[model samples]
Target: MSDPHKKIARKAELSKISSSFRRLSSRATLGAMVAGAAVLMFIAIGVGEHLATLALRENERLIGNDLAASVDKVLDGASTSSRANVKTLPGSPCIEVERKLAELETHLRYVRTVALVENGRVYCSSALGPIDVPLSAYVQARRRAKDITLLAETPFQPGVPVLAVFSSTTSNSGVLYIIEGEYLSDVLVHGVRYGAERAAFAISGNGVLDEKGRFHTAIDADAPYSTGVTSRAWPFTILVASSPSLMTRQRWAFAVASGAIGLLVAGLIAAMYLLAFAPRRLLLAAVRQGLKRKEFHVVYQPIVAVSDRSVVGVEALLRWHHAKWGPISPAIFMEEVESSDMLEEVTRFVLQTALAEMSALTPAFPLRIAVNIAPRDLQRKGFVAEVVAAVRSLPPNTTLVLELTERFLLSESALTSAAFSALRAEGVRFAIDDFGTQYNNLDLLGRFPFDYLKIDRKFVSQVDTVGADLIAGIVALARPFGVKVIAEGVETQSQHDGLESVGVPYAQGYLYQRPATAQSLATSISSSAASAQH
Candidate 1:
C-alpha cells in the first residue's frame, strides 16, 4: 500500500474512535441521571411506608383509649346513681332507684338503660320494669369485681345488641348501664381519610363481640394488621382492624413526591454534566475565579439629549477579561451564567458596581443610570429588595432605570409584576430595551409601566422618509402614555436630525461617543461640565 493511502486510512479510523467516545460520554451522563432519579424515588417510597405504619398504629391506640374512657365514664355515672339511692336498695321504696335510673338514661345519649342488680336479679330498672332473669357467670364475676367491667349480650327486650358496664357498690350490690353496641363501631370506623375500611370489637372475658355486639369477630379473624388495646379500668379490650388501603394511599403520596423530586434531581444532574464538559467547564471555572478575584468590570455609554447633543445619562455594560479567554463579551458569559443558575450573582455584581460608579460620578445633572435586568432575576422574590439596597447609597437626585429586553419583558409573571410595582413605588423607572424588534411592542407598552421606549438599531438604519415616519409614529404614540422614545444606532447627521425632528428626546449610539470605561466617561462628563462653566 502507498504511504498516503495508509495515512488516510489511519485518519478515518481515528475519526470513528472519536465519534464512539463522544457517544459513550453522552450515554454515561444520561445513565447517571436516570440512576439518581430511581434512587430518589425508592427512598421516598420506603420513608413513606415507614411513616404510614406508625400513623396506623398510633390511630388504633387512640381509638382504643377513647373506648376505654367512654366505658369508665358510664360506670362512674351508674355507681354514683346507685350510691345516692342506697335507701331504696333491694327493699323499702324502689321509687328512688327508678327515678335515678330514669334520669341517667335521659342524660346519657349512649346509655340504653340503667338498672340496679342484687343477688343475681334485676330489682329496679330505667326501661325494663322489675326483672327476674338469671345473671350469667360473666355478669356475676363483674358484680364481684371492685373496678368497672364491660360485657356484651342481648338486651332484655330481646334480639337487640347491647354493651353493659357494671360498677359494684359498697353494699355488696352493683349498678348496670347498658349502651348500644354500635357506639363502638362509630368510634372505630368514622372520619379517617387514609384508611379504607375499619371495624371495632369488644373483648369480654374469652369472647369477642362484633360491631353489633354479636359473639363473633368484628372483622375477619385473619385480617391483616389486626391491633388491640386493653382497657385500664375495665376487663374489656378494644381491637381495631384495618385494610391495606391506608398504606396504599401513603404510597401514592410518596409516588407523587418522588416524581417531583426525581425530576428536580435529574435536572440538577444534567446541569452538572453540562458544566463539567469541555469549554463550559473551563468557562465556569474562569467565571468563579473572576468573580472571586474581582475580574469582571463594567463600561458606560453616554445616553445623549437628542436636541442639544449633551450627555444626560449612561447605560452600564458588563465586561470580563479572563487570563485565558481574554476580553469575553457579556453576551457570551451572561448567557452561560444564566443557564447555569449563576445569573443572580452576576446581576448583583453588575448592579452593585454600576450604582457605586454612578454614585461616585456625581454628574452635574441627575443622570439616569440604566441597568439591564434578566427575566429570571426579575421573577425572584428578593429582586426588588436587592435593587432597593443597591440604590440606597446613590445620590438622591440621581435616577435608576431598569432596562429589560423585549423577550424578558414579555415573560413577566405575577411575581415579576408585583416586583416591578414595588420598585416603581420606590421611584425607580423601567425601559423597554430594543423595542421595535418584537411584534408585541404595543402589548408590552400597555402591560408594563415603561418610562422609555428605545428603538432598535435596525429601524434607525433605514435612514429614509419611511424611517422618519415610523420613528415619529412611535414617539407620537408613546407621548400620551407618558413614555419617552429614544433612538439607537444613530451614526450619521441625517439619523440625528431625523430623530430630533420627530421630537425623540434621547439617543445612544457611536455618533455621539462609543461605550467607554467608567473613568473615561467620568472624564468626559467633567470635561463637558468645565467647558459649560467657561
Candidate 2:
C-alpha cells in the first residue's frame, strides 16, 4: 500500500513539470511573433515614405522643365518677328514705323511697348508717342553690334519692372520691345494647382519675381523640398517650393493598407488575444453610438468661497451613461474622448448645457460658470469664436470663466494668446486650474494674464503641515499680479480653517457640497438663501 501511494505522488509531480514547460513555450512564441510584426511594420513604413519622396521630387522636376520650355517658345517668337521686319522699320517715317509696330503689338499679348532706336535715342515707339531718353543706357553694346540678338534688361516703366528685349537689326538702329515682367508671373502660374503655401517664382540676373509680380533680390533659401531649373533659351531659372503635404497623402495611403494587412496577420498568429480584444472594440463602438444618441450629461460642482462657505460659482464636469456599462467615470472616458475627434463635440455639449442650465438657476450673487478646456481645443482656428457664441445666452450679471491647466499654458502658442486676448475683450475671464503640479507654473504665470489660480488637491490635502506654508507662499507670489488664489479638496473643517488662515479666498470640495445635478443645485441654493434671510 505504501509503494502504491509513493508511485501516485511521483506521477503527480511529473504532470506539474509538463504544465510549466508548456506555459514557458507559449510565452516564447508570443514574444517572437510580436517582435517579427514590429520589424515588418517598420520596414513597410520606410519603403512607403521613400517612394512618396521620390514621386514628389519627380513632379517638381517636371514643373521646372515645363515652365522653361514655355518661356523659350515665347521668346523665340519675339526674336523671329522683329528680324523678319527690321529692314522696313529703320529709315522709315516715324508714323509709318509706329503703325507697323502697333500692328505687331496687337498680335502678341506680352509686348507692352515696341520702339525703334536710331543712333543713341529711341526714334519711334508704339506705346510712347516719342522717345527722348538715350537707349544705350538700357541696352548693351552687343545688341547694337550683332545682326540679330535678343537681350533682356531691367528698365523701370512707371513704378513697375519691365523686361526690355533689345533685338539688334542693324548698326544704326534696333527693334526695342518692353515686356511687363509681372505678366510672366501670370503665364507661369496659369492652370496650376499648387497648394496655398507653395511659392513659385523665377530668378534671373540677381532678381527674383513671385507669382504676383512682386520683385525681390533673393529667394527664400529655407523653403523645404525646393528645386529649380535654368531656362534653355535664357539665364533665368524657375524655382518651386512646396510643403510635405504632397507626400503625406501617399504615406497615409500605404499606412492604411499596411494596417489592414497587419491586423489579418495578427489574427492568424494570436487568435486568443484577438478574441479577447473584441470586447474593447465593442466598448468603443458603444461609446460612439452613445454620442449620437445624446447619452452624455453635465454636472456642476459648487466652488464656495473659503471666507463665507457660500457658492460663488460652479465647475462643469461631463458624465457618460453607457447603455451596457452603466455609469462610466469621466476620468475613464475623457482620455478616449480627447484622443479622437469627438473632443469638440463633447466640449460644445458641455459648454452649451452648463451655461443654459446654470443661467436659468441664477442665485442672488452673480453666478460665474467655470468650464475646463483641453489644450487641443485652443489649437483650433475658431475656438475663440465658438466660445463667444456658446456664452451668448448667459443670464444677466453672470460671468463665464475658462479654466486651463499649467501644462497647456506653459507652451502657449501665438494663436492661444491671441484667442485669450480676444475673449478677454468680450468680457470672458480665465483661470489657471490645478496649479503647482508642474515645474513651469511660474513661467506660465509670468506669460499669461490669469485672474485666478486653483491649488491642486494634493497640496490642499496636507494643509495642517507643509502644505499650509506652500499655500501661503503661492498666495504671496500671486499678490503682485492681482491674481486670486483658491484651494481645492477642502474635505474637513481643519483643512478649510488652515487654508483660510493662509489667506485662501476661495475653494471647491465635498466639505461644502459634492457635485450635483443642475436641478438639485437650484433647489439647494434657494433653500440656503431662504435660511439666511431668517
Which candidate number has the best lDDT? 2
lDDT of each structure? 0.70, 0.71
Model 2, position 56: C-alpha lDDT score = 66
With candidate 2 superimposed using the best TM-score fit, by how many Å does residue 378's alpha carbon deviate from the native? 1.5
Give lDDT: candidate 1, residue 311: 72
TM-score of 1: 0.47
TM-score, one value per model: 0.47, 0.46
Question: In candidate 2, where is summed lDDT lowest over 10 consecutive residues?
Answer: 143-152
